[model samples]
Target: MRPDPEGLLPATEPVTLIDSDGAPVTPARAAVPPASELVAALGAMITARRFNDQAYALVRQGRLAVYPSSHGQEACQVAAARVLSDGDWLFPTYRDTAAVVARGVDPGQTLTLLSGEWHHGWDVATHRVAPLTTPLATQLPHAVGVAHAARLRGEDTVVLALCGDGGTSEGDFHEALNFAAVLRAPVVFLVQNNTFAISVPLSRQTAAPSLAHKGAGYGIPGQRVDGNDVAALLAVLGAAVDAARTGGGPQLVEAHTYRMQAHTNADDATRYRDDDEVAVWSRRDPVERLRTFLTRRGDVDEARLAAFADDAERLAARLRDELAADLRHDPSELFEHVYATPTPQLREQLAMLRDEATRDTPAGGSR
Candidate 1:
C-alpha cells in the first residue's frame, strides 16, 4: 500500500533521543543508535566544537576575515557528515565550515571562503563538496539540479543540502522542494533552524507551525529532530539518506538547534538576545550532552575525550599556521573568476584598477 503523501512529516515534539541533561529520553521517535555510532558522534561533535572555537578566535585575531560559529550546532554539523558516504555530495552554506571539515575537507581549505581568499579554498570536484554559498537559499536549487542530473546519469549519488532558518522563507527554498518532490531526486534538505535568521526570531519569520511542515505542501516527507541531540540527528538523517538513495524520493529534515554565537563575528548577538536565553541554550550544548551520555555509559573516559581535544588542537594549529600567512593581492586576479566570459564593462573596470594600482605602487616594486 502507498503511504499517505500528507502523512510525510516529523514525529510530534521533534525527535529527542538524549535530553539536555545527558540522560537518554524514553520513547524516542526514531531508532536508538548503537554504542559505536554514539561514540563516534561524540568524538565528531567534540572535535567540531573545538574547531569552531578556533575559527572564531582566528576571526578575532584577523587571521580570518570573518567566521560564523556553529558553536552549539556541532551535532547537526557533525552528524550530517557522519551519515553520508564519500560518494555523496554535500551542499554547504557559509556557516557550515565544521560540517565541511568533518566531510574530510581540510580545515584550512574550508576557511578559505571566510578568509577572503579564493571562491573556495579546496577543489569542489575532488571532495564532492560544493563551494560555500553565502547567498541564502541559492544553493537549494543548485543541489536539486545536481541530484536530478545524477539520477538521469544512473549514478548512485545522494545530495545533502543545508540551509539556515532564514533560508526557509526564500523562494528558492520552495522551488527546490517542488522540483525535488516532482522529480523524486535523491536529495535531503537539512534545515538547521537555529532560532533566528540574523536578528529575526523564528516566530517572526513564519507562522506555518514549523519549518518541517513546509515540506507537506511540496509532497515530500519532513522530519524534525533535536538538532542538539547527535543520536537523533544521526538516526533521522541516516534514514532520510537511505530512503532517498532507494526510491523513497527526497526528504526534508529540520534540526531545531541554536546559534550560540552571533550570526557572524561581525554582528553582536548580545544587542538583540539576553544573556539568560543564551545561558539556557548553553546548558543544552550538544557536545556536552553527548559527552555526558557517553561518559555515563562508560563508552568514553576523560583520557579518550582529551585525545579528541588533542586532535582538534592539531587541526587548529594547522589552520593557524596556514591562514596566518600574509597574502599578496594580484589586483588583476579579482576579475578573472568573476565570469567565464568577461563582460566588456568588467574588462574596462579591470584595466582601470590595474592602472591605478600600478601607478600607486612604489618604484622599487615593494608596494
Candidate 2:
C-alpha cells in the first residue's frame, strides 16, 4: 500500500528538526531516513559545503572569477534532488549546483558550466539535467513547458524548477505559474527562500506573509518548509512530487533557509548586514547541525566524519585542476542555437562577424 500522503504532514504546519545549537526539536512531522541514506545525505551536504567554501577561497585568491556559496542551503537542494527519479528533469539556477550534483550530474560537467567552457554542460538529453541558467527566473517557464510536454506524451516524469525567493518577483515566475495551473502541468516550483536577494531583504520582495501563499493566486497547492532540516525538506518534496505525478497538478514550495555566505564572490553582504547577523545565521549552519545530530544519535562516527572531510578536500582539489584547464568558449557558439535554421538576418550577422574577424587578423597571423 502507498504510504499515507497525509502522514507526510500531520497538519498545515512547517517541518523542522534541530535548533541553532543542534538540539532536537519537535517538528510538524520528522521522518528520519535509514542509516545508509542518512549518511549519504550527510556526506553529500558535507561535500557541497566544502566545495563552496573552497570555491570562495579560490575566488579571493584570484584563482576563480566568481563563486556562489551553498553553505546553509544544502538541505533545500539535496533533499529536493533526492525526491526526484532519474527520468525527471531539473531546471536549476546559478545557486543550485548542489541540487545538480545530488540529481546525478557529473561534477566535471557542472564545473565546466561554471568554468565558462559551455553553457549547456552535458547533453541534457543524456543526463536529464538542463543547463544552469544564470538569468534570475527564466528557467521556470522552461520547466513548466517540459512538464506540459511530458503530460501530453503520457510520461510519468515531473520537472522541478529551483529558483531563489527573489526570482518570484520576476514576470516569468508569474507567467510560468499561471500557465502551469491552466494546463495542470506536473511541476514543482521549489523556491529557496534565503531571506535575501543580494542585498535586498525578503521584506522588500513581497508584502505577502508567505511565499508559498503566492501559489494560491494561481490556483495550486502551496506550502512552506523549514529548509535547514534535511528530513523535513525530503518529506515535503516527496509529498509534492507524489501529488504532481498522481495528476494533482503543480505545487509551490517555499523552503525557509538562509544564505549564510555572501550572494557571490563579487558581493559584500557586510555592507547591508552586520557581522552579528552573519554570526547569528552561522549558528544555524545546515552542515554542522546535521553532523551534530548524526553524531549525537550515534548514526555516524568521528572516523566517518574525518573520511568525509578528506573526500570533500580531494574532490575540491580535483575540480580546481579540471576547471583550470577548461576555460574557453567560442563566441559564435551562442548564435548557433538561436534558431533551428539560420534566418537571413542571422546569416547576415554571422557573415559580418566573420568578415570583421578576418579583417582584424594580420597577414600570416596565427589562426
On lDDT, the candidate that comes out on top is 1
Expressed as tens digits, the lDDT of each residue in 1-367 for candidate 2 is: 3324443222355667566566667643556556677678889888888777776776776556677877789988788788889889888888887778777776656755555454657668877888889888998999999999999999999999999989999999999999998999999999999989999999999998688878877887788887887766777888899899999888888888999888997888989988887787777777888888888889899899999999888878876776666355555776787888878898888888888888999999965
Residue 231, candidate 2: C-alpha displacement in angstroms: 1.2
- Residue 62 displacement (Å), model 1: 1.2
lDDT of 1 by residue, 282-320 (tens): 999998898899999999988988888888889889988
Model 1 misplaced stretches (Cα beyond 4 Å) = 1-3, 339-367
Clash pairs, candidate 2, are none
Ten contiguous residues with the weakest lDDT in model 2 = 1-10
TM agreement with the true structure for every prediction: 0.94, 0.88
RMSD (Å) of each candidate, 1 decimal: 2.1, 3.9
